[model samples]
Target: MKFYRLTFLASVFLTAVMLLLVYVFDSAKHSFSETNKQFFQTLIISALILSVINYLVVDFLFNFYGKRQIQKISTILPEEIRDEESNLNFKQLSQKFTDLNLKNTTEIDMMKEMEFYRKEYIGNISHEMKTPLFTIQGYVDTLLEGGVENLAIRDKYLERIDKSVERLLNIVKDLDMINQFESGEIILNKSRFDLNEMIREMIDVLDLEAQKKNTKIVLQTTSNLMFVNADQQKISQVLLNLISNAIYYSNRESATVTIKTKVENHKVLVEVEDNGMGIKAEMLPRIFERFYRIESSRNRSDGGSGLGLAIVKHILEAHGESIAVESVYLEGAKFSFSVAKAI
Candidate 1:
C-alpha cells in the first residue's frame, strides 16, 4: 500500500510540475495585458480542474488500497492474534495496537501469535497422548508384578490394557488424519456412489457394536434411492466418524442413532441424531475446535482425542458442505450438516 501511494504521488507530482512549467512559460511570453486577461483566466481554470480531478482520483484509489489491505489481514490474521490477559505488558501492547488504529501492525502481530499457538497445539496433543500411555503402562506393570499370577483377573486387566493401548493408537491416527486434511496432502478420490448403500454398509459394520449396546441404528430419507457424486471413501469416512461418535455418546444402555437426509434449498442435508449426553451451551461454539472436548457424561462413553469432529468439519467444508450441531443436555445431540446435491 505504501509503495502504491509513493508511486501515485510521484507520478502526480511530475505531471503537476510539467503543467506548472507550461502555464508559467505561456503566461510570461503573453504578458499581463488586458487583451490576454481572458487567456490567463482560462489557464487558471484549467489548473484548478486538473488539481481537483487528481485529488479525487488519489483519494478514491487510496481508500480502495486500505480496504483491500484490511481484507487480506482479516483472512490470515485470526490464527495469529493473541489475547493473553495474564501478561500485563503484552495485554497493553494488544490494547495499544487496537487503540492506535495500527491495522497493518496488528496483522503482523497476529501472524506471530499464530506461530505461538501452533506450538501450543502440538504440546497439548502430546500431553493428551501421554496420559493414556501412562495409564496403560501402569496397568501392564501391575499385571506383571502380581495380577499375572491369577488367570481370570489377569485376563480382565489385560483386556483393559489393550483397550487403553487401542485408544491411544486411535488418537494418534486421528491426529495424523487431521494433519493431512489441514495440509491438503490427502486428495479425495472422487467417484459415483449410492448414499443409502454407504450408510447401510456402515450400519452393517457397526451392527455388532450396536447389538452389544442394544442400540437401534436406523436410516431414513425422503428421497428414494438418491445418488451423489462424491469421493466415496472420504464421504464414507465422514459418516463412519459421526455414526461411531453417536453410538459412543448415547446416554441410554439401549439407544437410537438416526441418519436422516432430505433436499433443502437445493442441497442435501445429512443429519446424525443420537439420544446421548448432549453438549453444553458453552461448548457448542467450540465443539468443532481441534482438541476441544466436553467434560461430562460424554467422556464416560469414551475420551475424545478432539480431532475427530474438527476433521469432519474440515472435510465437509472442502467438499463445499457445512456442518452444525444442536443439543439439549442429557436429552441427546444432533449433528445437521449439508453437502451440495449431486448434479
Candidate 2:
C-alpha cells in the first residue's frame, strides 16, 4: 500500500513538470491556435500518458532496489527471524540490525574474557612446573659435581630431589583428575554411608598434622550416624582437603578446627570451620579456582598442589551439589556443602 502511494505521488510531480515544458514548446510553435477544446484534450492526453509511464518506471526501480537491500539483510539475519512470505520494512530491519550489533559485542567480550583466563592458566602451569624442575636440576647438578663423594651431602640432595619430584607428580596428578572431572570422564559411584563416621575417621587421620600446628579438630554433630548418598572416596577427599586447609592456615597459638553436621529436610548440611587466618572477602569468588592461592607466599611447600579446593568444588558439583564459604579476614572461615540424605 505504501509503495503504491509513494510511486503515485512521484509520478504526479514528474508529469506536471513535463507538461509545463510541453506547454512552453507548443506556445512557441503556435500549436494551441486550434480550438481551445482541442488544446485541452491534447494536454490531458499527454498528462495521462506521461503519468502512466512515470508511475511504471518508479515502481520498477523501487522494487529492484528494495529486493537487493532485503537480500543483503536476509543473509545476515538469523534463521529464526528470516521470513520469505512477508517483507521486512525499514523499521523492522533497523531493529534487527541493532539487535545483531549488541549480540556481536557481547560475544566478542566473552571471547576476550576466555582468552585472558587461558593465558593466565598457561602462565600458572609453567611457573608451577618450572619451580620443581629447577629444584630437581640444581640438586642433581650438585650431586654430580663431586658432592656425591660425601655421604651426608648425597643423602641430603637426594632427599630434596625426591621431594621436588613428588611435588611435580602431585601437580600432574591433580591436573589430570580435574581434567577428568571437567571432561565427564570420572563417574561417581554413589553409595549410602555414615557421614559422621567419615568425618571422625578424617579427623583421626589428620590428627598428627593438626597437633603439629597445635590445632585441635573437633566434630560437632547432632547424630552419630548421618547417612548420605554420595561417592564415598570423593567425599573423603573433600573432608581431607577442607580439614587440611583449616589446619594449615590457622595462625593462633593453639587453633581449633571444627567439623559440624546437621540433618536438614532431605539433605545433610556439613560445615568445616576453623579459627584460622580467614581469607579476604575480595578473594572469596576465586577461592575454588585451580592454582589460585589466597596468600601469594604459599607454595607447594605448604602441603598442597593448590588444586584441593578446586577438586572439592568439582566433586560436590558432580553430585548435583555446591559448596559455599564465609569468612572474616584474620578471624576465621567456614566451608560448607550439602549432600542427599539416604532414604
Candidate 3:
C-alpha cells in the first residue's frame, strides 16, 4: 500500500520537476547571467525537494491517522485491489468493494444465493409440515369427540392422515436431495444411456395421467439411439419432472407435450415442448425459483409441489448443464437444456 502511494506521488513530483525546467528555460535562459541562471535553477531544485518532503509528511500523517482503520482491514484483501478498500472509512465498505472489482461479483452472488437458500429452506420446511400437522390435529380431535365409533368416518380420517404423511415424506426426500446438492456430497454416476429410450420410459410412467385428460405425449429426437453421458438416475428425475410439469399444465383436451433430444455443438440437448396454456412472460424468468408458482396454475392438477423445477435446476447445474425456457402467453412453452457431449 505504501509503495503504491509513493509511486503515485513520484509521478506528480516528476511532472512538477518538468514544469520547473521549462519555466527556467523560458524566464532566464536569454536574459540572465550564467551565475544568476545557476542560482535560479538551484532555487527551483531546493523548492522541489522541500515540497516533496512536506507532501510526504502530510500524506503519511493523513493516511496513518484518518485511514488507519481501512489499512488494518486491508490485511484481508488480495494485494492487487488493496487500494480500492483503502478509503473504507464507512460502513458500506463491502458494497464499495463489490462495485469496484470483478472478484467481488462472484463472491457477492454466492452470498446472495446462500442467503436465499437459507430463507427458502426454512420456509419450505414450515409449509410442508403445516398440512400434516393440521391433518393429524383434525383426526385426533375427531376421534376424541366420539367420531371414532363410526368405522367408515374413522377410516376416512386415517386415509387423509396417510395422504398428508406421504406428502410430508416426499418433501423430506426432496429436502435431502437438495441438501446433498448444496453440500457437494452428490457424486454423479455418468454412463452411456439412450436418450430416446429414457423419454419413452418417462412417458410410460406418466402416460396414464395424460390419457385421463386426453393429452398426448409425442416423442421426437434427431436419433433414436442418441447416446448421452450423464448421471442416469439424476438426469432421469430431472427429465421426468419437466415432462410431467408440461403434461400437468396443458389445459386443452388435445394438448400435446413433446420430448425431443439432439446433439448440438458437442452437447446433447433435450427439450420438453408443450402446447399448454403456456407460462406468462413475466413469470418465465422466475419459474425455477423455489416455491414459486404461476398464479394462473393454481390447480393441484398442475402436479406436485413447486419444488419440482427448482430440483430440476439443481440437478442439471450439478452436472454442469443448464436449462432454459421460451413461452408465449397463450400459444405454448418450450424447455430446452443440454448435457455433456456424448462420446
Q: What is the C-alpha RMSD of each candidate to the true structure, in Å?
A: 12.5, 8.3, 8.4
Superposed by TM-score, candidate 2 places the C-alpha of residue 26 at a distance from the truth, in angstroms, of 28
Model 3, 1-343: lDDT tens per residue? 3565755776687677668767866785577677786767777886887677768766765655556777776788766557564665544565666666767677899999999888886886686577677778889899889988999999999888787777777777887787788799999899988878888888999989899878899988887687888999998999888888888778797899988888899888888999988888889988987677776437432236657888899999998988999999887899999988678
Tens digit per residue, CA lDDT, model 1, 39-139:
67866877787778778766766656655655455544443343332223434445645765677678889999999889989887776778777878887
lDDT of 2 at 292: 92
What C-alpha root-mean-square deviation, in Å, does candidate 2 show against the real structure? 8.3
Please list the C-alpha lDDT of all candidates, in the order they appear: 0.77, 0.87, 0.79
Top-scoring candidate (lDDT): 2
Point to the candidate with the largest TM-score: 2
The candidate, 1 or 3, that scores higher on lDDT is 3
True-structure lDDT of candidate 2: 0.87
Q: Considering lDDT, which of the candidate structures 2 and 3 is the better prediction for this target?
A: 2
Clashing pairs in 1: 80-110, 80-114, 250-276, 251-276
Overall local distance difference test of candidate 3: 0.79
Candidate 3: the clashing residue pairs are none
What TM-score does candidate 3 get on C-alpha atoms? 0.69
Per-residue lDDT, model 3, residue 214, is 80
Worst 10-residue lDDT window for candidate 2 reads: 80-89
